[model samples]
Target chain A: MRKTKTALLIAASTTMPALLLSACGQTPTQGAASPSSGVVTITWYAGPITGTGVRSTLISKFEKSHPNIRVKLISAPTSTNTDRANLTAEISGGASTPDVFNGDVIWPAQFGHAHLALDLSHHLPKSFFNRFAPGLAAGASYKGQEYGAPLFMDAGFLYYRKDLLAKAHLPVPKTWSQLYQDSRILQQKKLVRYGYVWEGNSYEGLTCDWMEFMTDAGGKIFSNASLTHSVIDSAASLKALTFMRKLITSGVSPSSVTTFEEPQAMAVFDAGNSAFLRNWDYAWSNSNDPKVSKVVGKVGVAPLPTFSQSQYPGYSNIGGWDIYVNPHSQHISQDLTFIRWMTGTQAQTILATKYSEIPTNYAVQKNPAVRRVNPVLNIVSKVRLVPRPSGTPSYPKISQAIYTNINSALTGSISPTAALKKAQTQIDRAVSSNSL
Target chain B: MGTPNPLEPELTNHASRPEKKSPGIRRRLARQGWAFALPALTIIAAITIFPILYSIIVSLNHITFTSQGYHFHWVGLHNYSVIFSNPLYRYSLFFTVIYTVVTVFIELVAGLLIALVLDKLIAGRGLMLAVLLLPWSLITVISAEMWNYIYNGVYGVLNALLIGIGILHTPVVWLGRPLIAIVSMMFADIWKTTPFVAIILLAGLQMIPHELYEAAEIDGANGSARFWRITFPLLRPTIALSVLFRVLQAFGIFDLPFVLTQGGPGHATESLALLGWQVMFQDLNMGRGAAIAASTTLIVLFASLLVLRAFRAQVGEEDLG
Candidate 1:
């Protein structure tokens, strides 16, 4: 009796584990079509466009139009790098719930090379790509295939306190030197605590800010268009970097700007503390919003100022999001439909007018009605746009090299010359795939 | 032997007879135990062992993701060589080690002092313990974010307080300079983890027999003498355990620095885990990332072993006792 009981217990326990293991292997039936209703559900992963339910609004609008499909919203992390990591793990691991995801505009080359994003050119009509503003469609392509559809456009703009500028009897500065002199006057007159605040933190945003200054001084990250060689240690870069450092030493800009990101810089400008803020298009609405801005009506937006040697408006680094389909997604057609609708006139108009996003749709971009709603949209065509050296998949590392070394110089940890030389060496290593 | 008893069969149940059945019973019990543990063991293998083994293999190969799946090209130690030769990786290694050593040392010392004081407290001990656990209980990311506000350069609370009290003539950018940023990050880490170390040491302190201290006191030993002779010697195993735990955790520091500075003002505060994450996810260099992870694991493993070996004699003696 005892022996039989032991045998029975052993059999039951062994089978229990097998049952558990088998149960663990099964995945949930997400993104699956309902057998009875014939309705399909797809997940869309996106970061916060606006805290005011923009995603849910868009989803409801889409679902109303296309009743056959249901869209589930998955809120992604606000940090772009964290979002990329999560998406990379999910797509690379073959999880297919997120049929579509919103990625950074700079991710096309890297995502395309890794096969993380599906080639939309293979699936969508060629005419679909033409709806985006000029240069946006090309920006969303890697090699010969388009991987993402540009959803919105963003560019750097110079935001100044009109009240402060007026108080100091200064016109809107058109050149870097002019802006510097004006800022000094504002600070010296006790009209403003600080002159300028921009993103200088050692992150992706710094790379964007660096590109503007570098290009304004005729400094190119890469000597050749193919991005095979880096000439970041040129004399032009030294001049640009030196001016940035002098801004701190001369007390025109706060020493703490070295730690500033978009929010911090924006906060300083919005609080009526700083005289100038270099930020993206969204700052126009943010600065004008009375709920958050002390200088609501006192702020004015203009194109970023260039160095004396360059033209009036300096380059604005292209910044925005792009929508892409996951290669592992089960609902490819539905994903494409969502992408098309998002970039369509109706949705683009909502984004532009309500949230003040610069629409990537060329029709909406050129619409006088939409441009009037968001003043930054009107100035976008005037400012020169420069693309980050993201033509290659190694752009992330290259950007890191630029931002970290440049940040060191900005912090006075190293000289501008040393920082540029180090950036050059690291960028070379990244291009050659020689370093981590 | 004198008489052949009726209970002779039971009485003669010698080693041979019982031992013969015991082996079969023991084997059956062992099998049953294993059957019951199989599910948990399988989960562990899947989650922990498999990833570790796969990460090591990945480190040895050039890995790329395609639509079909992952494609691996064997590259021997090329990835390791790349990271090892890189200055950034070298700096990260140096920074992580120094960070771990400094923070752990400070935490241990501070923890011991707190633990000693707590052990002697007569009132509100429970409340004190709960309060001390608060920092440790809060998530590292959340606490790090709080630290970010305190250390903000433009309008930080710390600056406001300092200026109000007239300690600082001007506000300092706490995370703007390399040295200051590293120190600030370490301070935040110490603030969060010291309480954990204290709690562990307190448990160890409680475990020591009160009579030992009493006996030492009766023998004319001073308070410091009592601690040095009785308290320190008996707390060796617990100290070893806490140190090992702290070293392992501190070496893999990520969330604090990641939130506080993102390994800036120029990668000055970058930890090994941060570097590995950046290389793997941000840069999409899987092989190099895996190499960094594998190397970190090996270093941690080696460090832990050394820590254990140093206290092996005391630990073994305690185990035997």
Candidate 2:
């Protein structure tokens, strides 16, 4: 009995401190010697997808090809902002974190500024980096250093009823003026209940819509390359806002558009209620599916219309997510290889085939098979893609300010010029603040 | 918390100790008491009080985590002044107050009527109670999504029903206009929460003696008079308690508007809690966000105190607790 009690005391004393110490684990030393384990494991964090996504098949193939590196998958909230917040919390805790992760297009600048993303310029040659679309590659850059590998691509398309346009004997609209003229003519002929519909809701979708208009009219948010001045308070932005309002006031778009996000607009358009709908390319496959839509085989797609003054026609906002490496991860070399392989032509083609993903790799996008599955892919490539101000850590706040003011202007609570001034003031304050 | 206690003198006097060894003995007893209470006190402080105190401190500083990790600097009253001066905070606060007052008033009156009707029913009272409670027991997300579909602009049943009844010539956009959107969200809340108020009032009604009503009827009193003299007076404390809690719950409502309209149509329906959450989590502006949180706590405490005082004026100091 005495022996057992003594043994219990010994065990308790030894295990007690270890249990207490687990609360604050040892800080991981940076740039330490790489682990010499038999295989390297790189954790990949992606948005919450349950079944076989683009990553699963790609990872299986990659594991077969590169036997030295193993892959682990983790799911995060589907929201980009939620993923950003969760990643920040995990990394700041100084504990285990995902080695590689997906980020929305706006994340490169914010994550790079926080020093969370590893710059990949030192890892890949300029020629290899040039394999992805130039417009998409630019979104993955910060301060002329590539921090992200373009994983997939998306662009807004102006989906119209080809039967209605043909009946009206109208040509495809190349510019905003012609779009408005054709929409009015179609409405007069009663070709559709509404001439056009788009997402005008007070959300991030509005930001995408606003950027499309602002960039088409040659308006940029910042005046200098150094991002010093707030010069978005301009007449060009005013014209963009006025045109959006005209879409409603002139009866070209429905008044109910104030409540629409992407899905809302898609639902109305799929119900055979509108002549033209502005949406992302994902809607192409869905609208063409005979099981779910009334407009199957009657839809035609084109890039969003542009201002007549624009040097480039039908310039839409760039919409895609990218993958970046976490600098704090110990398996930096393995993470880089994983990212390179996933973004390469072979994996891109699989993703396009399996998931209908718009391939970011220029060659995969040009593949005849991909074009057959996604007919809108070729038309999407012709549009110029202008990414928003994403290099700053205040990008989310800046986006909120822009969308809110534009919504207020659309609601007629404030004039377009007044809204621009208010937005500019808010942006300047966010920039001048000491912390994010 | 460590400041001098206001009741210390009364406590010592109530002890009625004047012996020579009393001071030393009291000191020993106090130390023993503190020793016994230490574990529980520590746990409570760590779990409950620590977060509130830390948020107060964070509210006074500008802090954010970068790749270098948390960088902090003192901003004193700057965060408070900035949020107060911003029009959005005022707008959110105003809408929150309006929603709380309007919902609480409607719920109390409606709940009383429901309880009265339930009290006099001859049969199927249990069935009616269960059916009424179904809304209260349903998950918030599922119900909000159901309401969203019902109010959908394209294929909503509400528009369909209204048009069929000839009340609307064409389909109306329910969640699009500002005032209508706020009302629509409130309608969903009323559907889910009025049963909760009704259940509480029903319990209060059951506790009243039936003999009091019989005596009033024998004394030639009518139904309305007896209700005013007996039932209304008897139900005052329950009404007070329910109103107090409903006010607080309504002020902090989030999921309904978040999932339903997202405080849209130009932020016509966003509550103070939603704005604080957006600042703290979404924008990652920790200091200003915590200040908004602390502001909410202060407002709630002040409102609760007012509620207590108003009830006391009507029903004297009693066991309302």
Candidate 3:
């Protein structure tokens, strides 16, 4: 009995280490095989698409064209965890199983730096760079090198209720003062709950909207490759912030706007309760969806209003996603091939015309098919893409400083001048500390 | 429970027989303990302890997400200094403390009340206990979403009820104002966590002997007097344990406020955990984020120690031992 017990203990001890080692080593492998012999599985992480069913249609087409290459589509979370967990796991584990990653435009730099993305300049023609809007090319570039191709482009535009404008006897607001006036008239007339709805919550979306106002007011957050100390605190930025404050405080915008994000603001506008909404191109399709939206036919798209006369055209913050190959991917050649095919003119057209994703390719943007699907393409052609301040390493820190101060100002926690002054101090400290 | 006789002949023979074989037996037992613990220990080390140590190392470095790859420079204490100097970080710290104190206090009081009510051996007591524990069993993420709808400005049941009762003419934006947003989040937390505390206390209530209460009644004690003299004293240890667990859980709160407010209505709801998440993911400042996370862990540890000390004081050292 004693001998048997001793043998059992020794055997258990020996097997334990083996079990642990096996558990640690069991990472999922990418299903990569020759196209002829086995199905070439390509995983794609995409954004939430509503109405048009563009993503599903595109997947079916891609699979049909290359019958051997099976496309596995996964939806990325709208929240933060999906981005953090998926990207971190892929980079840390050196796994390239997800052949195509739907990267945020702001993230290319971060991912590229982590050595998790493949440089697409090698696979595609150099002229591919020329096909996007001027500043859009920068969205996919890091340190003067192209890491990925722009999949889609989004520029902020003013979507308004045409019926409300007509009822209030107002034309589209040409300037900040005109916007405020129109909103006031509409509110007084009981045409809507407020004059406008916008994303005012302290987030990346808020920064995008604030940039449009700051740039249109002729105030820049940074200059000469470094944050311009006290420049964003200038008269122009204060003017823009003051106008925004007046609109909110004067009852032209509801208190709920303070908590609204992209979808929340869009939902209000689509419900026909708001006169104006400042959002991306994606809102166009949702607003035009006859089943869900009340003001489908009455929606109008125009450039965001301007404040300074010198700023000829109003600014629109560039927002969109791109596709990049993971550098650590074992199948680099295959990933590049996939990226090339996805961003090609043919695919871009299909994505734009079918899915409502504003194609990055200039040729696709001007394609007659795109115009037929969405008449707003003409306006998208004219709009310029404004790059985020976070294009540099110090951007996140800089953006936080700006948004924190702006949020304080908007919430009446601090005076605009005081907020701007404090913001300048914070920006200077961060930039100098980071050696930007 | 009887102690082994040291002078027994079998024990003496076993001790006197080669000491070398005894060492082997002891070694074998130690090895068995290790073998049983190794799998769990290895997993814990890899998933928890390793990341914590790695984060400390990363926090001391200047890391950026750029095109080339994670280029890092050793910049000791720089990230920590930034967090210390920033006013936003100060604001987040203040809000986290307020949230922790408010939520924990409310949950404790409400939990104690519910536990007292459920302590009576009423009809269908088992069913009532299960129903009381249902909220605790539900996943936090789902509850957060449900509460978000309740707090919604348009077509929310909360606002609808308030209006129906003629409380206000217009719908109040529960999550739109700064101060109100924090209060709203606290209410949600109190609703979800009070049940957990009740369950813990309920188990403690079951263990208390009925003889003690009977003796207290014979001593001419009233219900309130009996509760103070007999019940409260005995329940002190269980209450302390429950509060300690709650304080730790509340300190590290993320999902409730995150889902409901997204730290919004202008940074009013930004807790340490949410701020840490933003730094790590949104800003991609892993170094600074890790530093914040490390600091948070230390702060929570200190707070828990204080609570534990208070708990020991109430229960006395002998009972704890």
Candidate 4:
């Protein structure tokens, strides 16, 4: 019986591979038959960049206009890291099922380097590029090739409680120093527990906020795009970091801000416990909702403050993802059709007005309808977008080192100067090893 | 020689008999075994082994996420060297060890105490056991969130209760301070995991024969003395096993810390697993991430082997006694 069992096991193992191979041959025929019936299926994997119901409603409208095409929607995770992982896995698997992918602007370079995305440079008109904010087009390009079409963009801004400032008898602080003074006064009066709350966690959100301060202080991560060494250890960068540390030490901002990510900090500010918050434009809508926020209709928005008077104007780091076609897609024609339709003038208009997604198309940006729906687009229009350094293949590694050091500085585990120097050395090493 | 000859004749007769067996019967038996084992093996290979092997291979090279596909370079031990030399990685390892040791030690002692309390022939024994098992069955994510709410500085129940009773006049930022954050995380972990250990120890308590305790009592031993003499030695194996499981579980913990503190207040609560995840998923540097993962696997394997060996030694000593 034992001998029979052994023989049976060997025989079973040998035949299983043949069965699996035969099963795999049947899947593609099933997928191919759907697109031939005068019906094209476009699958989009994106995040809820705007309100929840907005993307679905717009897709529904697009389907209504073209009855033959069916649109399938997939939402990416709210976390940036998870979204990137999901997108990369899907692309690498070569499952053309998700015909279109919503990509972070930073990701296009990485994805383009892998040949996972189609070159959209020819599809996009030069006029379309001219209308976007100066650096946005460059943000979506890798090695002078465009792989994605920008859908919407985001930049950091300061949101302060109007009532708290008015009660404190203070005007909007135009510089970090002024903001610090005002915050101290508010805390002294017991009006708020914290002067400022922002993303200080060692994540991508922190990096975005940190870049705004670095730019304001006349420092850049890379002198040129090559990223041979970091410029973050400069005197300007040290000053910016030192000022941030002072905010925590001097009781302007809570020490807990060192652990705060976007949602955590947003929750603190939305609870009316904070006098000011540094976040993206999306917070404006959420903070004004009476159901969710304690300080509804009492919030005001402005540009992030700068430290130096002679530096170039204060800049907010540009965020938000783009939509791109998978290069390895079996249904390339159908995917291209979907991309064109989604970013087309009409779709962009509906998305901007209804969903508050800033349109990448310049023509849609000026539409009277979009302007009326979201007045905050005016802020987005003037916002400057900055790309991350180490844009080659080492972006994630370089960013992690930067955030780790910054986190150490924020937690009082290391001095700002030491943190910057360490970050510079680490980034320099990572770049040398990973750069092509 | 006579028995061997008879057996040989029987075996030869059986072997000749197999020629009459239907090929379909053999095929059917083979098919059944394949059907039984294929799903489990396939799942293990696909989800666990394949990824581990892939990571190992990737770690030896330089790979990066890009638009086309992963770019690779032959960097040989470069990634591993960088990780060892990096101070952040070193700190993460230290923290992971401290977290594992502290949590396992606390949980084992607490769990044993609870099990002893439950082992008595008291009223509502079944109900007590069920209630004691409740926290162990809860989803880790839900538990972490609940703890977060309880520890919230501004409106947390902990602060409100403490201040209301005049134990403290101010709210404490439970997750804000570095040392306090680590302790808070440990508190949350112990709350959720103590029940697991209790359940295991309860089974061990039930298995100890009552006659041994009766014999100890007859020798004029008190309850505590009887427990130390009769119950403690037999329970050592179970206790050791429970500690090993808990230690392994704590070593790879990710969700609790990720949801509760996200290895923050600046890496105070960072573990080896969290650091590996940050490298692999967050940084998208699968090579370095895999190296970290490989090291973690090796450490876990070494620790578990040592624990199992000790457990075996205790069992052997018990047998000799």
Among all candidates shown, the one with the greatest DockQ: 1
> By summed lDDT, which 10 consecutive residues of candidate 3 chain A come out lowest?
A14-23
Better of 1 and 4 by DockQ: 1
The CAPRI-style docking tier of model 3 reads: incorrect
Give the TM-score of each candidate. Answer: 0.92, 0.84, 0.86, 0.85
- TM-score order, best first, reads 1, 3, 4, 2
Tens digit of per-residue lDDT, candidate 2, span B11-114: 45634554445688879988999999999879755544555666678789987666656567899989998889877889999998898888888888998999
- lDDT score, residue B14, model 2? 38
lDDT on C-alpha atoms for all candidate structures: 0.85, 0.76, 0.72, 0.74
TM-score of 3: 0.86
Q: Candidate 1: TM-score?
A: 0.92
- Fnat across every predicted model, in order: 0.49, 0.21, 0.20, 0.16
Q: How many residue pairs in model 2 have overlapping backbones?
A: 0
lDDT of each residue in B110-174, candidate 4, tens digit only = 99999998888589998887887788888888988899889876567998999999998867778
lDDT per residue (tens digit) for residues A1-436 in model 3: 3322332232222211212221232244554545576666777666664332666777787777777666677777764344644565445444556777777777666566555577777666787678775677777887877877788878899998888888777888867778888988888877788788898766677788888988887788876664455468899889888987887789777766666778888888888888899998888888998877888889998888788445545888988888876665655665666666677787888778766778887777877867888766878766655777755645665766777677767767678899788778777866665421
Question: What's the best-to-worst order under lDDT?
Answer: 1, 2, 4, 3
Give the range of the ten consecutive residues with the poorest summed lDDT in model 3 chain B: B1-10
Error in Å for residue A319 of model 2: 1.2
Superposed model 2: Cα runs more than 4 Å off: A1-43, A48-55, A66-78, A85-95, A115-130, A144-146, A309-312, A326-331, A366-369, A434-436, B1-47, B313-317
With candidate 4 superimposed using the best TM-score fit, by how many Å does residue A361's alpha carbon deviate from the native?
2.2
TM-score between candidate 2 and the true structure: 0.84
RMSD of each: 7.9, 9.2, 7.4, 8.0
**Per-model tally of clashing residue pairs:** 0, 0, 7, 15
CA displacement after TM-score superposition, residue A232 of candidate 3 (Å) = 1.2
